[model samples]
Target: MTDRTLTVITHVDDPSIGVLEAAAADNSWSMTMVAPFRGDPLPGVADLDALVVLGGPQSAYEVQDHPYLSDEIAYLREAHAHEVPVLALCLGSQLLADALGGRSRPGDNGLECGFIDVTATDPESLLNGTFFSFHSDSADPPPDAEVLARSDRYLQAWRTGRSTAVQFHPELDGPGIEALLALEGAKLRQFGVDVDAIRESIPTSGPQPGRRLLDTWLDDVPVRDPAHH
Candidate 1:
């Protein structure tokens, strides 16, 4: 029998997560991708068994610049209301925060690009080790959210109902690292980001953490049963 379907939402092409695909395969699940950057229409909650929102370069609060983000947030809120499971990263996580009455913005400590280690609130957290980080913003969970982890500066992971969100990019691999460099390296350098350190951290960070995250999500999170093939 075929497994359940997981809907993946991407704001940009560069942040496509191979780990998500692999984990879906391992879990006997199928994946469908929706790209707002490419003008893809957002899928309804009924069309998904689970939802995953990937990282992007845009800030979550910039609804004016990225109008689709508002719709995305609305959809997420709807999904949550219906008890659908969600796993969101970086910008996606920020959006999730907004949907849940929380918020995110650029931090005073500067950009959190590259790999970083975090403190987990429990043993089952996906934030249990060093993972990829590539954003300037951090999320503040809602009053009822279960904060699973925290970075030195802000919240790293949280959950509310069936949804889980993380401020780090645990979905990135080598190609993803290269894609970020090719797309934003010069700009990041001009912003005083350490390209050398980010590059050095790449080898150590690898795709394992991302895969582990995907695996953990599949294992721990609640999902509707897979339909027959």
Candidate 2:
């Protein structure tokens, strides 16, 4: 654990994992970044302490258009199969679902875009229930995955083996949300989103300390065993 190194895969620039980086720093973990959208090479999962896949606007099912994502899903399967830790966010979560023999597709429940309450069933919510969201896709957990959190509309979080996935954006903050809306507001409006209402829903002040519960998840990532791969 002395040379703890983690990898983060970011699809786009805006919604980068802001708070989660701090959690990584808290443990002095070094992060290697890969951006498939930019054509960065995906690293071998067995080589790192953990794998973190960040949110993006693309669907996990969009591999045909973004074929590099097929490589990503393949890496996730290798990671899961070898029992490496994974913390997949939003689109990454969907990719994890697909890697685990499930899928993420557009749902009839409409878009869940904005700050929303998420019910935690495992350890339960000790802090405020709200987490930021901006996607229409939902996922089915693998047969062995534990449903950790949810909203009335979608599966917010789950885990299988050492891998954890979440549809919400716990890594996003005020400026990040503003940037996301700037880029996607028009398309979201076409989906029946009220831009002003969503803006108003954002907390005026900084979020509570426990805002990034990923700290707990990262803390629990099991040590990588050379033989496991």
Q: What is the TM-score of each candidate against the true structure?
A: 0.90, 0.90
Query: Compared with the true structure, what per-residue lDDT tens digits does model 2 show for residues 1-229?
Result: 5758888899986445657777788877888888878988877766878988988878888889999889999889998887888889899999999999888788658899988888889555532388788888888878888888888888888888888888888877666777788888999899888987877776767753335586777777777778867
- lDDT agreement of model 2 with the native: 0.81
RMSD, one per candidate, in order: 2.8, 2.2
Taking the tens digit of each residue's C-alpha lDDT, what string does model 1 give over 7-101?
Answer: 89988764557667778888888888898868899876765788999888789989999899998999889988877889988889999989989
In angstroms, give how far residue 125 of model 2 lies from its true place.
Answer: 4.3
Candidate 1 has its poorest 10 consecutive residues by lDDT at 220-229
Write out the backbone clash pairs for model 2: none
Superposition TM-score, candidate 1 onto the true structure: 0.90
> Residue 89 CA error for candidate 2 (Å)?
1.0
Residue 130 local lDDT, model 1: 81
